[model samples]
Target: MRWRARVKQLLLVGIGTAIGFNGVAVAVAPGRMQTAYGIDDPTPDLTVLLRHRAVMLALIGAVVVVSAWRPPLRPTARVVAAVSMTSFVLFAFGTGVNAAQQRVAIADMVLLVALATATALPDEPRPAARP
Candidate 1:
C-alpha cells in the first residue's frame, strides 16, 4: 500500500480504538460521567440514557475500525464517525461544556481533522485481476 493509504488506515485504527475503549469504559462504569463530565449526582433515568449513549459510541467506533480494513464500508463509517464527532462538538459548545467536556470537545475536533485528512487521501490501489 502507498504511504498515504497506510497513514489513513493507521489513523482510523488508532482513533477507532481510542473511541471504543472510552465507550467500553463508560459503559462498564456509568459513574465515569460524574468524574468525566462533572455530573455530581445523576438520577437513575440519566444513568440509563448515558449507558445507551456509550453503547452507540462503541458501535460507531467498531464501524470506523472495520472500515480501516474494508474499503467498501468506508463511506458509511465516515458518515457515522463524522456525525458522532460533529454532534458532540456542537452540543458541547451550544450547551457550555464543563472543563472535562471541553477537553473532550477539543479532542473530537482534532480527531475530525484527522478523519478529514484520511478521507482526502488517495485510496489504495487494487491488485490486477487474473485472466
Candidate 2:
C-alpha cells in the first residue's frame, strides 16, 4: 500500500512536470519548439495556434499536479491525462515517423503507460474509525 501510494505520487508529479515544461517551452518559444519537433514551415498563425494549445496543455498539467494529493480530483485528473496523452501519441504516429517524430511518439507512449498504471491502482485506504 505504501509502495502503491509512492508510485502514484511519482507518476503524477513526473508526468505533470514533463507536460508543463513542454507547454511552457512551446508557448515561450514557438520557433524553438518547431525546430525541436522537426517542423520547418512555421507561420505566425500557426505560432498563435501552437501557443493556444500550449496553454491548454499547461492547464491540464496544473490540474494533474494539484490533484495528486487531492482525492476528490484524482479521477478527473487521471481521465484528462489519459485522454491528452493518448491523443498526443496518436497524433505523433499519424504525422508519420521520422527519427524525431519517433522519439516523441515513444516518449508519449511511455507516459501513457505510466498514467494508465497509476489510474488503475486502487485508491488509498482510509484511516480506521474510532471505537
Candidate 3:
C-alpha cells in the first residue's frame, strides 16, 4: 500500500510536470505550437485562443501538482486531469491524427491511464495494527 501511494504520487507529479512544460511552451510560442500541432496557418484570433488554452493547461497542471500534497484535493485533480486528457484525445481523433497529433494523443492516453490508476487506489494510508 505504501508503494502504491508512492507510485500514485510520482505519476501525478510526472503528469503535472509534463503538462506544465507543454503549457509553457505553448504560451511562449503559440505560432510554433500551431505548426507543431499540424496547423499550417494560424490567424491572430487562433493564436489568442491558443494562449488562453495554454493558460488553462498551466493552471490545471499546477492544481494537480499542489493536490499531490493535499489528500482532499486529489479527487478533484484526478477528475480535471482525466477530463482534460480525454478531451484532448477525442479532439485529436476528431480532427484527424497526423504524426504529431498521434504522438500527443499517445501521451495523453498514457496520462489518462495513470490518472485512472491513481484515482482507483486508496488515498489514505493503511491503519496501524494494535500491538
Candidate 4:
C-alpha cells in the first residue's frame, strides 16, 4: 500500500528469496556448488565454498528479517541489501554461467536489484525515522 510498506516487503523478499533460499540451496542441494558453475571439482572446494556462502547468507538473512520486522534500521538494512546484492553479482560474474543458462544467476541478480529498488524508495527515509 504505502511506499514504506513496499520497501519493507522488498527487503524481506529480497532476503528470503535471495539469501535465505539461495543459501539453503547452496548448502544442502546435492552438487549445487559444483553444478552451479558446471565445473568438475577434484577437491570439493566448491562444496566448502558453498557451505561458507550459506552461513554468510544465513547471517545476512537474519539481518534482513530483523530489519524488516523492526523498520528502524531500514537504511542499514538497505546497505546490507546492497552488499548482499553485490555478492551475488560477483558470484554471477565469477561463476561465468553461460548466457543461455544464467537463470539462477539472473534470479539472484533480480533480488539484488529489488533490494536496490527498496533502498531507493524516497518514503523509506533514514533508518532512525523508519520505526
Best by lDDT: 1
Candidate 3 lDDT over residue span 1-131, tens digit each: 58877877887888888777778778887866755577667788888888888888888898898887777888788888888989999998898878877888899898887788777877767589999
lDDT of 4 by residue, 1-131 (tens): 37677666766755655566657766677366555545455257756866787777766776777776566766676677667667666877887766533765676677776776665555544457554
Off by over 4 Å in 4: 1-7, 34-42, 98-101, 122-131
Tell me the spans in candidate 3 whose CA falls farther than 4 Å from its real position. Answer: 34-36, 126-131
Q: Which lDDT tens digits does candidate 1 get at residues 4-106?
A: 8789899999778767777877789987987766776889998888888888888889989999999998899889898999999999999997998888888
Q: Who wins the TM-score comparison?
A: 1
Per-residue error for 32 in candidate 2, Å, reads 2.3
Flag clash pairs in model 2.
none
Q: RMSD in angstroms, candidate 2?
A: 2.0
TM-score of 1: 0.94
Candidate number that wins on lDDT, 1 or 2: 1
Better of 1 and 3 by lDDT: 1
Model 2 regions lying over 4 Å from their true place: 128-131
lDDT of 4: 0.65
Provide the global lDDT of candidate 1 against the true structure. Answer: 0.86
Ranking by lDDT: 1, 3, 2, 4
The regions of model 1 sitting more than 4 angstroms off are none
Give model 2's clash tally: 0
Output the TM-score of candidate 2: 0.86
